[model samples]
Target chain A: MLSYLPIQLIPILPIKMNYRQAKTGKLLIDILPNKCDFCGCCVGVCPEDAIELKEAEIYIIDPRCTNCAKCIWSCPIEVIKFNKEGVLEK
Target chain B: MKEEYDIIVVGAGPAGSIAARYAAQNGAFVLVLEKDRDVGYPVRCGEAISREGLEAFIKPDKRWINAEITKFGFVAPNGKKVVINLGKVEGYMLERRIFDYELAKTASVAGAEILTRAYVNDLIKENGKVAGVKFEFRGEQKQIKCKIVIGADGVESRVGRWAGLETHIDFRDMESCFQVTASNVKCDQDALFFYFGKEVAPEGYFWVFPKGKGTANIGLGVSGGVGKKRSALSYLNNNLENFFPTANILTQVAGGVPSVVALEKMAAPGIMLVGDAARQVNPLSGGGISSGMIGASIAGRLAAQSIKNNDLNYINNYHKEWKKLRGKKHDFLDKIKDGLFNFTDEQFNNLIESMLKLPEKKRTVGRFFMIALKNKPSLLKEIAKVFVV
Candidate 1:
């Protein structure tokens, strides 16, 4: 006689960044390469032209970027890094 | 196939028109666009502003004002009232529909091309930089090249988002508001009334801004969290009508106000966001007209200077200058908003009771704020803590 058993389902988790780091506009910068995804997500989402992609690479052209965190939030690859020296880790 | 401008201002609201006016006054080719068939056709504000804030920009023409206010009334939950004399604090109730349209006309007189029923759909980019905008005018889509784009789109701004700026505002930081121009209300036309009670409007307050004898803009702004079960209009309809039983509703409007912390940033390369689009509204009062117009003036002047100098970095300077000018006041008001919204009904009642105990001559809103701060030092302490965090 076979006994029926209940199966447990584990949920898939998203790659989570440190909330404290994100709040302070600090993140690991080494992850991003020179080229942007060219998806135009950051371009469309920016209230300011702080982020611009040229030749498949994204650059924070303006130092006055308010760091509203919209670009980081919208980036599909999570490659945009926020650092004092400007993407130092990447 | 038309003329090109140095600066293109989208939306003909207070911010857009003011930006156009300033840019044009500086000899920049300015074009102002209005999507609506007419400027300020459907009014959506309580229309109350400090005379001082207005005077700082320009002497407000008499045609815009509906009535001048010289006193204020603060009503508690149990019907207790406190009256504050105007002293040197002067105010006005305006007809915004006329006021906004007139402001746009002023911009046109300054040599800015004002176009109504024009809808801007997308930004025209050259070499990955914003060079102009593609828009629909009278059902024909056209491209107009510009050196700078000033987004003065009011609360529901799409221009900023399209330019790649994060313009997201949390629901909790918003105030869902509703207003009606009612007649036969039993209130002094020269005095503005503010009612505070959880039952009346949880996490928000009801306002009666009188236009003239027996007529006023009666409105309520409820905190978004408190509006889960019912809308702000329903809450106002439930409580305000009973207060002025004889009042008859004339016009109705529903809108949202940002009561959150101001946006950390307001500008980016080749783009500047002003007015409600940049969340420049006062956190405590949710007022933006004066602030927006002032911001536009500064932005327009700076944008023109930047373009003349071939400085693409002008957007950053505009943000820095605006913050240096108005950031402190905004931060202080934001602290007050956070404390006031977090207060429970019991705490609010206690605050009212404490204010009621004060002498009539000393019961001003400014004084009330001082007393509340003194009594509940934790409120200020929390503000300090935010900086540390």
Candidate 2:
């Protein structure tokens, strides 16, 4: 029964974003909103130290993320999405 | 309201819980601090424990068992499968969250106080000896002074760091892993599978351990370091269709394992490390639950003995006794693991091809390892010196 609940309903986040869109047109790694439980494994494996957790919010500083995909690959919950441009808009 | 206690153990996983339980059971005032609000909130393991060692501590209970497996197979990059059949393999895939929670509860019932949401930030040191820990308990700062501090805080432990121990590992020795519990897998409910090859899991390996009928935990460990290419999740994602095309994800998790040992130094004057924090995993298989609990048992009993006797030197026994217990075996495993990681994909295929030549009935776990090492006589001799001695 616990698995059946939508990830958003799991309460991994109290302040949930609907979606993080890639505004830069460059390849971006985005955390699919509401699904990330903020486990911080990505922050641990990021080669560039681009990913950071500030005030319980997960963000990949635009300058450091090389689109190496480690952050997306390292995400345990699998909520990280990779994009060239606004992929979540679809 | 004395803040000082006899023993303080951090992290309520198996090692910490067992240490606390034994310390309290021996009449020492014990306290356990867990950062997570829940005892086993995010399961980071493949959850398999060999009955060979686990039974020595606690009897098997139905509540925490997911599946009991008796057979396993290793598949090489070339699809050569070597099936190992034993009269009994004695491995269990656990529901770790519940298992850890129950273990902590057992410690509490044994007289150790348990606290959740307590994030230990630093050590309370007096004259460069660890006397206690400073922690943030649910939004408030709290510090407790104790005679002994046990660090069972997983792989990235700072407690060991604060004790001035070099808890660092070569990135190559670290296995970055991603696993998922899922249903509709085509694996045998009573058997486990290991897949090897550079394309499959790089230097580590991929595994599928079934929980029950049509469900299992499928995952892989990718080689970790600065120049690491593929991620464990991507490898599993790319290969899941090859093995179980119909697999449906139930739960997914990502983690890293310190596939090494703490033979050099696992303790200081007043502090000790166990479990992943102690780097106590089997280097070859990266399994730790049972071995860690065994270390914890030694640490716990010695912590109690030393305290009860007011002999701080008894704390020294934690290292000696634990080494006497499992140090040699883990060292052997590390050597074997390093050897295996250096094997090329063709070597994996060759190893599998060689193993497959044995009669299916002769492919028991013992023989598989024996024959795998037969190719490397020097390593075999080293294994003999460590394990056989």
Candidate 3:
């Protein structure tokens, strides 16, 4: 038998990292107000017109979002983020 | 207590400011609310505008001009260059920050009450008509009532949407645009350069607009679907660095360009959408500064008239006039952009290749366009329609 570390230790061995890489599909759009500067770049960069800026606050429309993170790169502060299973990506 | 006004315009961009000025000039108690502390700070535009478009509304003022463009040029995928002198057409690279502020100043002088850092959060809908707005100012929520609300709130306008108008743009008609101001770049100080290639822009184009003697605004726009995998910044940067490796980026900007026909409905019982909110930008050029100002002037005059007549429905006349003024022309450009959007890199190359074979004098802008339509002869009929109707 190949020498194996204790199975109980597996849970504590950064196993969450594997779960993150396992996420191959599903797109998530997250706009954190703290990271946003109200530059309105995302409003202009969005291809689907999914992003809205009202009273300086930005919000994403669910049906129109399309998970296309072009808006993410549009942010100067890089506050807009796209994720696959909580893994932060542009 | 909610303040009352004859007309209230949301978002004091060019459209809002100009609308406010016009409304006040027409004897309306006009009020303008701006979410941004600075009127035109953090500009998210390429800032290039045509002279003809500018003259159609504003009397040319040097205070807002950054560059007086004399020539405009294009580079094809095959590395061919075509530059044209500004014959009858005039163009300028605007200093939008100063330009917008000056416009706002005029509005204020015309007796429009302008409040900056005032964010309009929600609409006070009354019996299916927009009657007033609740906004946040200095961290306090405030409300104001008005007879007419001009939605000059830009491409991502909520005022229009809140008034129950369809404000969505199709992905194909939207251009995800990114731009950067670079210092010490090699640029034609008086000419604008546009680069075309699938690998360069992918259903869009890259542009270099000179701001001054040595500084330039370089950017590109890519259509929505193809941009899903990459960023507009990446495409713009990669191409820019390839040309001017030593250029230092001074500022960066990203935004969307609405390149489509006007929305089906731009006015309701008491609300009217102007500028990009109404999809008034040129589909082929991704420009709306002049068009928005034109739309705002019409809206301002109409809003004042509606209030004076005690007929809130006067907003409809504004909508109708806007269609006749710019909407019809934009609709024609929409068809042209739709056709150009499908052109492959090879076709772009062919277009340049064919144009280069023409005699020097025959290679006019008008002639170049004619040859591009040679293969797609059917498009000529539509082109004629653009003029006939």
Candidate 4:
């Protein structure tokens, strides 16, 4: 009888975790402004269409980015990287 | 902005200008939109082209010619050099800033309207077909209708993606590149030098293309996705002093070159992609100026013909025609590039050393490649497939 209880009655906490948030809570991809030469290498290889090269600024759209690290690999000057608490690494 | 045009070209580079020129010349009302404030500011190219390639479009001008390359130099990891004297000017390093402007001017003379500082952000579709463009100019949004849209926007082209063409490339096929135009540089004035080694470029090559009068474009391209510990620019910076100790760096650029045979699909109804947008660059040499121009010329002419005839078939001919014109050669070269670039550092040192054995007159470019291929039977077989026929 207990097993037959309605499933809707059981309150379940919604588990919402994106792949990026699951891996590292601090998976932040940003460009090192001074080192970025503004060549569109990052824009070309982005699978998610996350990077944008404006007049003199490059923006990585947060919601669009899956943080696949393709832009990180495409950069020739190593300007784009994952920022973990003010420290940047691969 | 005009409300309508027969054809619209995006990005105003060599490919866009040439496309607009040809389309307009063929009686199409053409419009070209350039995002840059100027035609060719903030140059990202190495600016090297063969003599035959440049002469095919416009007459060579003194104002735009930076250096007339008459020789070639190859440097191995061991610092050995092999120079090929072509006996006459067979290539030119262009002053791209002026050259690109001249190209756009040529298109304008051909009766195409051009707008600079106009950024195209979206493609307007009608009946599930690309029919127009929406752009931003002077802080205002503008939309224009067109019968055909040519995506000549370079490597980072968004036009291709927006039009639903598969323009994404494998990381291995993209050359992560950095280049600098420097003054007071020490290098050959009439020759282009290529430096090869894993430590130097890592699955790529370094180049010193002379721009005359103690000026040169020093650059390097490394194959992408190799997961190299250091960046291409970092590698260039580490070894730049060795090549040019007294170099005074003036301008620096970072970019990517798509080193593929060609994209699988470059065209859709009412739209076509040309130049780097189509990945029309040579796989081995990574040069695209001439190829892009050749492709745009075909695309422009066909786009006009398609609109004139009211037949979509003419537009698709661009892919077939371009393949016959340059695509086959690119496929052959792509195989050779993979085979040649995989040589170990010692193999490169030996290959350069072997070139010394041949007489100076016998050491032509053909002979140089023949000797390089003799050691690798796989590459020899690949060559036989082309020439043995």
Candidate 5:
């Protein structure tokens, strides 16, 4: 039941906005916020050091993330995926 | 909660709790900070631990045990199964949520102050040495100063990086893993099962650790590099039906296992890293509960001694003591794991077939490893050092 609770109980001031909406034609990734359990596998597998798992939230450095898709598979729950909007725009 | 203490331990997992317990028992003022609202939640492990490894620290309590394990089963890619009866209870499938809370309770009973929902933001350094920590608790920013800082944070630890330790893990040295606690699952409650080969786990292994009669934790870990070609989830999803056809999923959790023996350095001036933060999990098995607690016990005791003697050198003893305890064996295990990474499915099938030929009583994990590594005499010799004891 604890895993089902949303982690973002406190409003986290967005440090870096996910650029999928603002910028297009570039590969970007997003996560299903509720599905993730904060396992940190994505953070450990990212070769570019693009993902960071804070206690309350996950941050993907948009510039550093290259749509490598490593994090996509590293995830156990398949919460992370390539942004559909970004892909369509491209 | 205090302005100053003898030691500030980050995280309240098994390692942190053990570290804090020992530190407090040794007469050091200790404070433990946990970012989660509770001590253990959102479990991220398969939760099987060897009985011998655990008894060395605390008595096994039924309150935290899910199942008593006595048999081990290994399934090759070709579907050959080799079952080894350990002859007695050898391990336990734990309820980690309760187990972790009990450990932290023991630490608290030993006089260590514990704060939940205390998110550590950064290390407070003075003149190039760790002196304390900056943390947020209950929506309030606070700083606590201490003589020594112990990093027991799990896989995503930043304390080591903040203290300038070379804690970066090569992707190959990490296991991208995920697990699901499912009900209506059928597995031997008294045995632990492992499935191997490329089709099963892709350079790692699939595990079914039964928690009770009809429930189990089923998971798989793939070499971090496999993410480039396929994800671990895909592999598990594809195979889960064949293994547990009636499984009704309950909860899903994903985590990384640092498949290395230990970091190059685990201690710096006024600081020590324990458990996953220091890569203390066994390389071959990816099991950390016992090893992490052992390392934490050493770190906790040493943190107290170093502060008592007013000597930072005592902290370095934790690294050396850990090597003597299990670090050396883990190093050899890492090498064996590297050899396993290249093993073809045919090899795994052959290995299991050979094990099946032996008398069931002789089909122990040691004998299986011997046959598996017969091709590499040097590695086999190194492994003999572990089993010979």
Candidate 6:
């Protein structure tokens, strides 16, 4: 004599974390202006779609980016600007 | 125990062994000391040599070669490919471990005594001249006296520094490199691939020297400035793994190569530095094996001749002969290496595009120089002047 009951379940809440905090301090995202020739190499090799070429220039979508650094290696121009502060001191 | 020899070679690498072989064959007592527990262990080289260069010392022995390459593929920054066919005078990918050990055997056969696990700490100087070396052998310190000391030690050689020579290298003149012997990559066994691009390698190039079917030494050398912030190893790990996902890594090595102008001097008062210690590597290709051996051969013969005649003045002939043989070529190549390192990404892309347009048969090493000097004909004019002079 068992009665059917509605399944009691708990929903896991999505954690809100900053992009810079996710990859510790090592994560760097760079956006190169006019230097990127839309080679599609970055787009093809990026594990995360943080890098996108629009109108023949590479732009890092900061909010959607995870800062994995896959884009930096894929860019043949090597012109990507690092998102981290104090990384590009001359 | 007190031991004495006519000539003492400080390393057991190619240069040292060749020097020892020549000296021993010339009826001079020679001793070759090696610091490594095993000769040719922890190999650090691109392992490729031209046939013309190899034939100068010893004939090609197939046992030590991994592959014989007859073609070359040069890829530009824009992914354009240029293929060059070399019918004869082929290059080789060597198995250095076997090759170096075999070289030591050749020296031994010529009556040279080789001692392993002997680390030379300081050179013995008598009356302000190099006499021999004091070294640690089997955890015990020992000193051996000899007439002439040959410092064939590799890069970072303290022997040269200890002897009061200026051997310090600038970071701008160093190429940081990373390489791994990978298997299961789809590369042509008969061709060597060279990739050039700021994106690929900031200051240098990526190479694929095949060993056999489905295997090759895949590597890259980047400029030191780019490498200083990150690393050459990090750049390779990021780029190469994606292209050759299935390629299994058998061996990995990271090192620096000199891209500077050749040393103005090579010998001083009973001391001669050969191989990387002397900065004999080709600044552009970073190939030192052939040049180093050639330098060692000349040095050994001259050193022995000088000892026999008791004429130290004849040593200057060795320096003159070495410069006559290859110094100009090295100077020209150094200029090219420096020019390539300073190219911006856009300029690099333009140069590559221009090079790709060249006819296949005309794609010589000389042509690359011409293309690099397109806007500035002064370099080409200077090269021509050198040729004429």
Winner by lDDT: 4
The better candidate by DockQ, 1 or 2, is 2
Show how many residue pairs clash in every candidate, following the order shown.
11, 0, 5, 0, 0, 1
The sequence of per-residue lDDT tens digits that candidate 1 reaches over residues B113-201 is 98887777788777756778888776688889988899886665667667777786665666767788998887888888888877887
Task: Go through the candidates in order and give each one's C-alpha lDDT.
Answer: 0.73, 0.78, 0.78, 0.85, 0.85, 0.73
Task: Tell me the tens digit of each residue's lDDT in model 4 across B264-382.
Answer: 88899889999999998988899999999999999999999888898866898888899889988888888778887789999889889999877888778777777778868888788
DockQ of each: 0.02, 0.09, 0.20, 0.41, 0.31, 0.02
Error of 5 at B6 (Å): 1.1
Comparison by lDDT, 2 against 5, better one: 5
lDDT (tens digit, per residue) of candidate 2 on B1-389: 25888999999999899989999998899999988778887888999989877777677788888888788889999888877776675888888989988888889999999988788878999987899999887688889999999998876566877788777555566677888898998887877799988788877889999887688989988756422555676788888978888899999877777787764788898898888888888888999898889888888888888889998778887777877788877888787887777777887787888778877776777676776677677777777777666
TM-score-best of 2 and 3: 3
Q: How far is each candidate from the true structure, as Cα RMSD in Å?
A: 11.9, 8.4, 5.1, 8.1, 7.1, 13.2
Better of 1 and 3 by lDDT: 3
RMSD of 3: 5.1
Estimate, for each residue in B220-239, the C-alpha lDDT of model 5 and write its tens digit: 99876786577777788888
- Per TM-score, the best of the predicted structures is 4
Q: Relative to the true interface, what fraction of contacts does candidate 2 keep?
A: 0.06
- Which parts of model 1 are misplaced by more than 4 Å? A1-90, B385-389
Docking band of candidate 1: incorrect
Show where candidate 4 strays beyond 4 Å: A1-27, A84-90, B382-389
Q: Considering summed lDDT, which 10 consecutive residues are worst modelled in model 2 chain B?
A: B222-231
Instruction: Compose the digit string of candidate 6's lDDT tens values, residues A62-84.
Output: 44556655545434345555565
Model 5 misplaced regions, further than 4 Å = A1-35, A45-51, A61-73, A78-90, B376-389
Once fitted onto the true fold, the runs of candidate 3 whose alpha carbons sit more than 4 angstroms away are A1-27, A32-82, A86-90, B381-389
Relative to the unseen true structure, what is the C-alpha lDDT of residue B369 in candidate 2, on a scale of 0 to 100?
Answer: 72
